[model samples]
Structure formats: structure tokens, C-alpha cells
Target: MPAEIALLFWPLVTIALYALSRVLYRHYPSAWTSPLLVTPLALIGLAIALHAGYRDYMRGSHWLLMMLGPATVAFALPIWDQRALIRRHWAALLIGVIAGSALAIASSWALASALHLDASLRASLVPRSVTTPFAVVVASDIGGVPELTAVFVMITGILGASLGSWLARLLPLRSSLARGALFGMGAHGAGVARAREVGEEEGSVAGLVMILAGVFNVLVAPLLAMWLR
Candidate 1:
């Protein structure tokens, strides 16, 4: 393959696979069909078959990662639409964010400790519960590998989204705010998408909660790191 063609390959393949996965999900609607699950796996398989290096694959896909900033900002539209809901439930949202962030950090710490991971790996795992952008930053600030943190974030998201779905069904979460917070706090970006699937209000609340959690973690991260030290 020519240099230019090779550079474009993974990005093009990623976009096409994601689109196809979305179509499959809409038609079939199962965990197996999830674009979140399918697209990356397909890309990995393709890359392996073609003997593509990780650096080359990333060179093409970095642009897509940049889009996440705009996408995260776009979530503000939903949050703005539900300002009344937020105002009415400010106390609940505040409590939930605080508690959820604390628990997530604590659990990450415990998991890493149990595994006896080194400090760098332990730091990377600490911010796995938040969305990628936040996790990446937090990991860096705490002396972790940003790239490894991103992978952990994705894994955390898939698991959290799945767990949130199961809990939503099992628990009697009558309020949209409650349901939204459940996924948003647990899964971050993936949870927000899943919350959106559930309802507009749920999605909006989930977006708001996810944003809040991200911001909270970011602001507290420096202090948290110092305290841990």
C-alpha cells in the first residue's frame, strides 16, 4: 500500500465498521451488535491480519479521538434543555456525584491494590470510571500512562454500561433522575448514550451527571494525588 493510502486505511475502516455496527444494532439490538463492542474488535482483527503496527493504527485514528472533545461539549445541549430538572433536584444530583466519584476512586484503588500493580499501572486504573478525556488527564496528573488509562476507560465503560442496564431492570428506579444518575455515574460516556436510549429526560440527566462527575474528578485530582502521596 502507498503511504497515503495506508495512513487513511484504519480511519476509513473504523468509520465504516462503526456505521455498519450501528445498523446491525438498530436491526438486531443486542449486546453482540453494539457498535462500542464491534467496531474496535473488527479494527483490531483487521490490523492484526494486515500486520499493522500500533503506532500506525493510532496515527490514522487519532483524529477520531480529537472529536471526543466536541462530542463531550455537545452534551451541554441536553443539559441546558433540562435546567429545570437540575434545579429541582440539585441536592440529589450533588449527593450522587460526590458519593459515586468517591466510590469509583475507592474501588479502582482497591482493585489495583489487590492485583499488586505498580504505581504507574495503579494510577492509570484510578480514573477508569470517568470518560476518556477526563481519565487521560487524571492519569497523567497522577503519573500514569495516558494511553493505558484510555484502554481502561473503555473497558470500564462497557462493563459499567452493562451493569447499569442490569441494575436498572432489577431495581425499582421510578424517577428519571435516579435512573439517569445510575448510568451516568457508573458508566460515563457509554452510560450517557445508554441513558439517551432510555428517554430524553434520562439522557439529559445522565449527561449532566457525567459532566459533573468529570469536572469533580478533574478539580479534585491534584489534591487527591497529593493526598495519596
Candidate 2:
């Protein structure tokens, strides 16, 4: 295929793969079978099989990347629908998110330091808990590698989505909102998807929490970076 044709075709191929992964997940319904878990690996394998360069794949994949910001902002609609419940617990939610965000930043820094990573790499890992769209921007602003941040975010999401339920059971958490908020703040979109598996209320709360965590990290990460430096 010509380069332009391949570039145009990759996006459709990516979407088809993702859709097929979702269908498979519905049939299998296991942690490893999750669409989020499966799709990226499939894409990587497909790319390797085709010997496609990252630069070319991204030429098409950028379409989905471009949509990420708008898609994230659209979460507000669900939040607006749940405004009543949110208002009732606004204080608790705010406190929980702030604490979670702080912990996320601190823990990432500590781990990176323990691993003896360089400053830029440490910065990239700092935003690992936030969703990729937010994490990439934050990482760039903080002298981190945006690509590395995206990788960390993906790994975090997959692990969180896969293990979160089992961990929750181990913790014996009683509140759906708490569970949702933790996962949302810690794991981002994949966690939100997993939250939906529990209940609509959990999913909505997770979506809201994910948005809130993103906003919080955006505002706080740069400042923290400066202070840590």
C-alpha cells in the first residue's frame, strides 16, 4: 500500500480492532478479556506483524487522539445528570479526590525515586494515575516525556481495571461512591468502564471522579514539579 493509503487505512483498522475486542470481551467477560486490556496489545501485535512504523500508525491514530479531549469533557453530561447526588456529598467527594490526587503524586514520585529514574522520567511517571489525555499534557508541561506518560497511564489503567475488584473485596469497601472515586482517581477511563460493570451509580460517580482528578492534576502537577525540583 502507498504511505498515504496506509495512513488513512490504519485508523479504520484500529477502530475495527477495538470494536472486535469489545465484542470478544462481552463473550468472555474476564479481566484479561477486557476490551481496554486486549485492544492495545492487539494493535501492537498487528503493527509488528505489518512492520508498520509508529510514525505512520500515529498519523491515523491521531484522529482518535484528537477526539480524546472532547470525549473527556462530555463526561460532564453524566455528572450534570447526577448533580443532585453529587451536591449531597460534595464535601466528601472533594476531600476524597484531593487526598487521592496528593497520594497519587507522592507515591509516583517516591516509586520513581526508589527505582532511581532520572528527573524527566520521574516527571512522566508522576501523572500516571490520571487519564492519558490529561497526563500527556501535564507531562509535557512538566518536562516529562509525553509518550512515556501515555504508556504509564495505559499500564496503570489496565492493572487497575483488572485487579481493582479483587482488591476492593480484600479491602471490604462498603460504599460504592468510595470505590468508584478511588478507581476513577487512580485508574482513569478503564476504571470507569469497570465501575459500570458494578452499577450505573458507580459508573457515574467514577466518571465524575475521573474528570475531577484530571482537573486537579492539571492544576497541581506543574507546581508540585517545581517544588520537588
Candidate 3:
């Protein structure tokens, strides 16, 4: 294939695999059966079998990454639609965002420090519960490895999805809105996705909380990093 045409090939292939993974997820219906887990594994295996370098694949795959900004911005529609609910729960939502963001950073930093992880790793882990784009920027600002930050974000998401449901139930809080807000503020995008499965009201609250959490992290991480230093 010509070089220009070849450039599009890998990206198309990745998209197809992702679509297939979504289908499988819908069919399987297991907590472990997430497209995020399956799609990357399938792509990595294919790349290895083809002897394709990760760098080369990334050159094409980055198109998908670029869309994250617009997708995030689009979430504003949901927020606008739910403005009434947001206004009603503004105080609780604000508290949840602050507490959740702080807990995420503090928990990761303390654990990593206790385990004697290097400074760079600790920095990367501290932003793990925020959205990936914000996390990457925060990690870079703190002199952490963006690649390591991405890995930590994925780990945080998986842990949240797996355990958040049980944890929410254990809490005395019976309001789905509050429960979903807690999960989204603590887990970011993955928790919001899980919240959608619970109910529409919960999902709307989750989306708003996730957005607030991202904003909180971006605004506060730099200050926290300075304090830690």
C-alpha cells in the first residue's frame, strides 16, 4: 500500500476492533467484560503480530485522542438540561467534588509514598482519578511521565467500576444522585459510565460530577503539588 493510504489503515483497524469489542460487551454482560479492557489488548496483540511499533500505531491512533476534547465539551448539553437539579443539589455537589478530588489525590500519594515509589511515579499516580486529558496535563506539569499517568488512570477506572457499586450500597446514602455523584467525583469517566447503568437520574448526576471533578483537579493539582514540594 502507498504510504498515505497506509496511514489510514491502522486507525480504521483500531476503530473496527473497538466497535466489535462494544458488541461483545453488550452480549457478555459481565463486569469484567469492558471494551476498555478488551480493545487495547486486542490491538496490542495485533500490533505485535504485525511487528508494528507502538509509536507508529500512535501516530494514527492519536486522531481518536484528539476527539476527547470535543466529546468532553459535548457533555455540557447534559449539564444544561439538568440545570434545575444541579441548582437544587449545588451544595452537596460542591462538597462531593472537593472531598472526592482530595481523597483521590491523597490516597494515591500516601499509598505510593508508603510503598516507597519514586517521586515521578507518585506524581503520576496522584492525578489518576481525573479525566485522561486533564490528568496528562497535570502529570506533565508536575514532572510526571504522561504514559505512566495514563496507566494509573486506567487502573483507577477499572477499580472504580468493579468496586464502586458495592461501596455505594454500603454507604447509608440512599439517594441515587448522591451515590452517583460520589462515584463520578471519585472515579471520573468510568464511574459516570457505570452510573448510567443504574438509572437516568444517577447518570445525569454522575456526568455533572465528573465534569466538576475534572475542573477541580485541574485547578487544585498545581497548588497541591507546590505544597507537597
Candidate 4:
């Protein structure tokens, strides 16, 4: 195959696989059958079977990656639509988000240190609670491996989405806002998706919390990284 044709094929195949996975998960929704979990595994298996290289796959997948920016920005619309609720609870939200954000950073650093991880690994771990693009940029600024940071962010999101509902039930959380905030702060976009599954109010608040948490990480992570260095 010509280089251009090969590149094009990979992206198309990836998209088709993702669509199939979504359809499968939608029809058979189980914890283990999540599209988020299934799509990646399916892609990896296909890539191995096709003997596709990561660089080539990424070349084809870049378009999908680029779309993430706009998709993230679209969350702003929901936040704006829910502005009244946000204003009514701004103080509590801000305080709660900040506290959660602080703990995320602190616990990540402490755990990495306990494991004797290097500075690079610690930097990558620090922004794992936020979205991928935000985490990558922040990780890069703080002298981390952007690739590793992206992986960490994805893992955190998947785990958050998978466990959030169970944890919510197990905990003493009495309010939708509280549960949503916890999900958003801990898991980012995946958590927001899970929250949406629970209720519109939970989803909306989770989206707001995810955005706020991203902003907090962008502003604070670099300073913390510098100090730790």
C-alpha cells in the first residue's frame, strides 16, 4: 500500500472499530463491557494482528485527537446553561473542588515518593485527575513525559468511571452535587459520562467540576512541580 493509503486505512479502521464497540456496549451494557475498556483492547488486538506500528496508528488517529479539543470546549455550553445553579453554589463548589484538587496532587506526589519514583514520573502523575490535553500540557510544562501523563490520565478516568457508582453507593454521600463533584474531581471526562448515566443534575455538576478541576491543575501544578524540584 502507498503511505497515504496505509495512513488513511488505519484511521478508518479505528473509527469503525470504535463505532462497533459503542454499538456492542450500548446493546450489552455491563461494567466490563464498557466501550471505554473494550474499544482500546479491540484496537490493540487489531493493531497487533495487522502488524501496525504505533507511529502509523497515531498518524491516522490524530484527527480524532484533534477533535477532543472542540469536544472539551463544548462542555462550556452546559456550564453556561447551568450558570444559575453554579452561582447559587459557587462558594461551596469552589471550596470543595479546591480541596479535592489539592488532595489529588498531594496524594499523587506522596505515593510516587513512597514508591521512589523519579521526578519525571511524579510530574506525570500530578495531573492525572484532569483531561488528557490539559494533563499533557501541564505535565510538559513541569518536565514530565507527556505520553506517560496521557496514559496515567486515561487510567485514572477509566478507573473512576468504573468504580464511581459503586463508591457513591458505599459512601455517605447524600447529595447529587457531592457525588458529581467527587466523580469529576477524581475521574475527569469519564466520570462525567458516568454521572450523566445517573442523572442530568449529577452530569451537569460533574461537567462543571471537571472543567474547574482542569483549570485548578493548570494554575497550580507548575508551581508545585517547581517547588518539588
* Candidate No. with top lDDT: 1
Instruction: Please give the TM-score that candidate 3 achieves against the real structure.
Output: 0.91
Ranking by lDDT: 1, 2, 4, 3
Off by over 4 Å in 4: none
Per-residue lDDT tens digits for candidate 2, residues 59-103, read 867878899889778867877888997898898789988998888
Per-residue lDDT of candidate 3, residues 1-229 (tens digit):
4456557978998899989999999999675778878888898898788778877787767888888788777867877988998899999989988988888888988999999999999988888888787888778877788888988888788788768888887889879878888678767788888888888888888888888787778787678768866
Which candidate do you rate higher for lDDT, 1 or 3?
A: 1
**How would you encode candidate 1's per-residue C-alpha lDDT over 1-229 as one tens digit per residue?**
5568878888998899999999988999875677878888888899888888788888768988898788767767866877898789999999999999999989888888998998888888888878887888888888889899998888878888889989999999899989999999989888898899999888888888988898789899999989765
Q: CA lDDT, every prediction?
A: 0.86, 0.84, 0.82, 0.84
Indicate the worst ten consecutive residues by lDDT in candidate 4. Answer: 220-229
Per residue, candidate 4 scores C-alpha lDDT tens digits across 75-189 of 6787799899899989878987899888988899899999999889998898899888678778988888988998899889888887888898999988988988978888888
Query: What's the TM for model 1?
Result: 0.89
